[model samples]
Target: MQEPSDVLVLAERHGDVLTLTLNRPDQFNALSEAMLDALQAQFDGCRDDTGLRVVVLAARGRAFCAGHDLKQMRTHEGDADYYRDLFARCGRLMQSIVGCPVPVIARVHGTATAAGCQLVASCDLAVAADTARFAVSGINVGLFCSTPAVALTRNVSLKNAFEMLVTGQFISAAQAVERGLVNHAVPDDQLDQAVSGLVDAIVAKSPLAVRIGKAMVYRQLGMPLPQAYEYAAGVMAENMLTDDVSEGIDAFMQKRPAQFRGK
Candidate 1:
């Protein structure tokens, strides 16, 4: 199904990378129901496209994202089932970013708080501007950032994740890098160039290798060391069977650049 033309999430296809820009700057790009649906739709669209190699999740305006639309949630508040369903929907949206075959990189320009922070944590990688800030700050409003914690803890240490969840304190982009929430942070002026450079470098690689590696890394993180290696060895064996692997080896032998079909 096609989303409306006036989607809260604006998608731009530039060569092999799809940049999904979160609109609603006036609202700090809050993940309203419409925004969540739009984001999920774009992810779904990318899943079957063999030509697509990466996704750059970005947002416009002052804040990257401010979490769920408070006004919308409060409208349906006091209804247990409504809250449950809403959270479940949000979880699915976040999962799609991880589940997508292609790598997803967060192009964080400003504050990403609560569920917004979860969005950053959920991406395969993130690059933030120096002006950006992050927090799992639902606690400030008397609600613990339980769902955000799911993704946050996966990307960071237990103690670090817990402190952010409980303190409602916003951390600088540099601190985000140190805590492992983001890969790195650069000057605000360099943010766009940094994201573009990273994406360009990634899409130039064998898409098949990138796809398999990104997925395996996330999966193995949950397993015991021995089991993880076992699982990884199997993945490598399968990857080696691909035509891209053979092409890469041949190119290396020939002293030429690889032209991968991602086969």
Candidate 2:
């Protein structure tokens, strides 16, 4: 497909993989109105397209994302409507990432702070380079990252999340992984390889299974133990009826690799 304006660069394919690159490297890929709009549009398109399987969120900068552009926020100071709308748009963007039918992966290479860390947590999976660092430092600037707290709280423990928010200290990639913030921490030079490995693992599965499985996992996460089991049972029953499952079962019985059409 044709690229969109270079402001929100999206490289997509039919085989269920899409890569979105935040293009504002000069400001450490900070979120801009144009970038947010482009991301919203791209994700909206992905929602409609059944062929899409996964999304890899990356950036073309030394830093993955520094968070909201303070300059932009300053420009809209005293305009309550503008601030409200801007944050609302950003929240929707993050929600889209979470609610996406396909799994979303955040590839973090450098500093991810405040809302940037929120973006990483919002994704289904995250792979960070050894050089990467994360912080929810909004409190240091007198603004609490109330919005980012939503995703952060869900991903890490209450104590861990509170520590990051309250202290605003930068945590290493290894520390992040241990705290359940990142799925994998790799050498900076091998960041690409590590991400590719993750993508390969994801794409190797039946697309429909992966998509539905991801959704079900999130759906049941907040449920009571018994209710979660009930929900999972229903999903499992439905999943067993799909053609991909049938093929997978047959392939296993026959001791051969299965070729899934993502049906």
Give the clashing residue pairs of candidate 2, or none.
16-53
Off by over 4 Å in 2: 1-6, 12-14
lDDT of each: 0.93, 0.90
**TM-score, one value per model:** 0.96, 0.95
> How well does candidate 1 match the true structure in TM-score terms?
0.96
Predicted candidate 1: what Cα RMSD to the true structure? 2.0
**Residues 1-263, model 1: lDDT tens digits:** 65634568888998888989998899999998888898999998988998999899999889999998998999986999988988899999999999999989999987999999999999998999998999999999999999999999999999999999999999999999999999989999999899989998998899999989988998998899999999999999999999999999999999999999989
Scored against the true structure, residue 22 in model 2 reaches a CA lDDT of: 84
Q: Please give the distance, in angstroms, between residue 202's alpha carbon in candidate 2 and its true position after superposition.
A: 1.2
Clashing residue pairs in candidate 1, if any? none
